[model samples]
Target: MKTLGKTILLAALAWAASAHAVFAPGEKVIVLNSGDGSISIVDPVSRKEEKRVPVGKEPHHLMATPDNKELIVANASSNDLVFLDPKTGDILRRVPGISDPYQIAYSPDRKWFVSASNRLDRVDIYHGADFRLAKRLPTGKVPSHIAFSADSKLAFVTLQESNEFITIDLGKQEIVWTMPTGKQPAGIWMTPDDRHLLVGITGESHLEIYDWRARRMVKRILTGLGAHNFVARGDGRHVFLSNRMANTISMVDQQTLEVKETFPVPGGPDCMEITRDGKQLWTTSRWIRMVTVVDLETKKVLHQIPVGKSPHGLYFQSHAPRQ
Candidate 1:
């Protein structure tokens, strides 16, 4: 019955649509928080702006429900999360009372959402489907970003104030480990195999590669300048780190833990993600209101489409890569 309902809905959309569009499979439509109080939706295929909706002030990261039916924007200045209809750019609802909310992460099972608050030094875990606050998990000073382990058993949050990563055991709902990193660790990513966790430190241009099983930082890969947020390729073979100061994306070899390529991007590449088929990579320039799309194979900019002001975090839905 659920499948039938989806089919019927797709049929209705097809009947109403004008043309067949190629959507990047597993490629999520990324919304950029243009600090000017607007969210810009980027269509990866067309390399064009799909929609721009007015939002709250200083919107940072965004999270979509497991079903992808809803997208929530973390409005840092407004101290709320604004929920929206992903397909139609409609404001559905808003959850309030968060202090300086920054990055957002979903549980592997997509049951819960944990959003980090910079001013409050806490993470608010929300019921994924309902957007209800389930638990308030406390952390160290200036919690920056959050990443969950592959098994979804643990969550690692980077604390900027103390330069440490706090590991939270999801099952027990407790802090199991705290690993220290360089100054002002900002963004983090768990490898595809779930064996290692990569942390990007802002104060220093370094990538901390931690062996999760070993519970320690075994290797530190040096980046060019201002290594901030990052995303891994679909194949998990390479990781792209957004070097904000250098205005480039540094492709690091996951196996060797070495920088393989340093490609130029727009000013202040804050966060990035790859298409599901791993054909194109997209990054949002923080200083500029544009989304830079890079062709993975040729390593060239295909488009620099305008978005909202001060665009920050990005998200992509998983889909079959273009053949």
Candidate 2:
């Protein structure tokens, strides 16, 4: 049944028809306040927070559906998902009973959804749009982030506390192997060609590049202290890495595996989103409780909009690809 899984056609069509309410101009940026159990909607024009709405507990990460119609916020402590209007940050619906969904994402193939239960130390594989649980596999500890192969046949999860990375064979519904990572690996990313896997070492000051097909570390680039998360540059040439301890973010060449440049950003940059034209960046500053806007051309912060405590994840309806 896993191989034969498919989304309900009627439901997808209905949702597509109703999606006209989204993708409007003046789309707001949504920031998840993990410490406050609420979210802030920022007016893109003024670069200020316009409104704050309560969502759920410990909402750490979020992503758009494969169809790009709805935004899914994973409320870790609440153990549920809150779907919202991608354009306005309005509540669309809630799906409960998901256990400890700290970081959630849908595979590129649109065949599977994965939740990394950081607290429960497990990974749950859900099939299709209904998100029915298909398998529960326990990881060692603190599964922090996830990235999938382009074909979506494999899922790579980083265990922050265990210092390991694991790959899930989606077709088999099982983890095929576990390998050692750097100290406190948090963010995992795959090159577009799926040739390399970049592991962010949060406990260290560098990134470890692994050849996934060869299952070995190929290169290590010194980024900054406590490299924690990643965001694509939208140009397809480079990707940005945030270093919490160093208070800086490094831009790395995706092909050459070199640190092209590093820029200073204050207060522990976590998750990030970019503008469609690739000129501006909106990132969450966790320790400082602010949503920062940076001018990519100058590599300087343009505005630091105060929101709530511990803003972790961020998104906007019109933005660059999450590559």
What Cα-based lDDT does every candidate model obtain?
A: 0.77, 0.89
Q: Distance (Å) between predicted and true CA of 114, model 2? A: 0.1
Model 1: residue 282 alpha-carbon error in angstroms: 1.6
TM-score of each: 0.82, 0.92
Tens digits of per-residue lDDT for model 2 on 245-295?
998999999988999999999989989887776877778999999998888
Ten-residue region with minimum lDDT total, candidate 1: 18-27
Which predicted model would earn the best lDDT? 2
Candidate 2: stretches off by over 4 Å: 1-24
Winner by TM-score: 2
lDDT of 1 by residue, 1-323 (tens): 99999999886676224112335332336565647888776655445677787888888887666667777788988888888776545689988876667788788888767788887888777776666777788889999888887777788899998999998877777788899899889888887677888899888878889997898889998886788887776555877888898787898888878899888887788877676657777788888778787877888887788888788867655532211
* Regions of candidate 1 where Cα sits further than 4 Å from its true position: 1-30, 42-51, 97-99, 316-323
